[model samples]
Target: MGADHAERVAHRVSGARLVAVSDADAARAGDLAARFPGVRAVTDPLALVADDDVDAVVVASPGAAHEEQVLACLEAGKHVLCEKPLTMDGESSLRVVRAERAAGRPLVQLGFMRRFDPEYARLKAVLDSGRLGRMLLLHNTHRNKSVPDTFRSEMIVRDSLVHEVDVARFLFGEEITEVTVYSPAPTSAAAEGVVDPQVSVFRMQGGAVVTNEVFVTNQVGYEVRCEAVCERGSAMAGRPWADLYTTVAADDGEGLWGGGVPADFLGRFARAYDLELQAWADASRRGEVVGPTTWDGYAATVVCEAGMRSLTTGEPASVTLVDPGPAS
Candidate 1:
């Protein structure tokens, strides 16, 4: 994601310039820098964050590293766009939230790219227009090509389903109040002990119930879909992208329905990424932070932890939150 964002800012996004990049591997950073003349390559992001030349920071580092990095950037007063799961848990994310509040203005924009996706934006507009009447239920389906060897059972919610977590918030304009996970038997396509297909129920503050069904090793394609059921009618999104793509279909039941899905997420949400970065860049240039905030990141972590606990406890869990107040 770090590399992806750097490319977008360098070439695609307007008003954004890629000045420097850092990676754990200095060579990798240098290689990325080689693509753009005058872009500095660094071995440490902390140095980049503190550089006076760097007016803003993009935290595409792994979730564990996010807490300190995001805090450092904010303390240095650099505008930031941090990728989701926001600090791996609620407490760390909350600290960032408080820090942003202490700064007296929003400074961070979370990377919940679905908010910028054309299909999702249209769906949200319909819901907001009351054309869908009152949104009653939202059904979310996330089917991935496969999971990596390092992927674990918990990632089903922490990583994949996390998108839907943020999406539900974006569409309904409300926070999730409760979440429950139902993990069935692991699929053969999944990592040995990992749970492949899981279902989660998320209850929002506005009486909307969302059922998110995630399949990481669907062996089909990369597909994400959502349907909003309302008083007047129901609407859906997530048609396969027009770009070149494929999926897996073995001699089995689930695989039997497999066909063309996006080859990867980038091709699927390319425009969304561009729009999100463009918005962030435009806002940062204006001395403001907009789009998803630190509070939204904090909320996502809270819901994920609750769902993980539910997976073990076999019971519904309530989502808890710190009052975001004005910073949100």
Candidate 2:
């Protein structure tokens, strides 16, 4: 993801430069350094954070490593942009939030890039305009072709579906009060010993209800979509492209075909990535928090952990949140 972000930053912002990159895999780090001229490759991430030439750090490492890396950057007095699902669990997220508070400044920005998407922004605008009236319920679907074999079973909820969890919270503009996880019928595409699909039901603070379906069996393509039903109207957003059909001459007959997934996840979120980076960069320069803050990341992690507990126990789990004062 760090490599992808670097590419996007280079593409969108001509003035941006890749200074240094670090990863556990030495060869991979070397390749990235070679791809971006003048960028140094290192195995220790702390080195990148401590570099005198480095202005800021982008923490795109694994979910488990984010909290430490983010706090380290903050301790080093450098701004940080960390990727989503902020940490493996809420405890670590809280620690990072506290670290930011101790620093007396907003040094950490959570990467909830979907909030910057034009469609989502438009939806928010409509909601704020009172056109949707009182939002009553929300339905979100996040389907993918398959999950990597290396992915742990717990990650299905924490890392994979957490995207919808965060987005749902953002859209409702309220915290989730309670959550219940349901185990539906199994899917053939799902790996053994793994629940290929799951549904999470959330009760928001303002009496709004939300259901998120995270499925790993949409073999044809990858899809991320949402629908909001309010008192006055409804709104939906998803892939905007239409199927392109072409006539083919075959021995049997002429056939038409149309379907393809987004080339890559980064490609699908290209605009959001650029907007999120620019927002964080501009805010950092002005010494303010313009994007998602450490509190947002902590809240999302808390909700995700609750959802996981709900799934494991087959019982409704209530989320406990710490009021982190005003938004950073």
Question: Which tens-of-lDDT digit does each residue in 94-166 have in candidate 1?
Answer: 8889888988777899999999988898888889999769999999998888778798878888888889999
How far in Å is the alpha carbon of 269 misplaced in model 1? 0.8
Candidate 2: misplaced stretches above 4 Å?
Answer: 239-259, 324-328
Pick by TM-score: which candidate is best? 1
lDDT of each: 0.87, 0.80
Question: Tens digits of per-residue lDDT for model 2 on 54-108?
Answer: 8888899988788778878988999888998678878888888887888888888
User: How many angstroms is residue 193 displaced in model 1 relative to the true structure, after the best TM-score fit?
Assistant: 1.2
Error of 2 at 276 (Å): 1.4
Worst 10 residues of 2 by lDDT: 239-248
lDDT of 1: 0.87
Question: What TM-score would you give candidate 1 relative to the actual structure?
Answer: 0.92
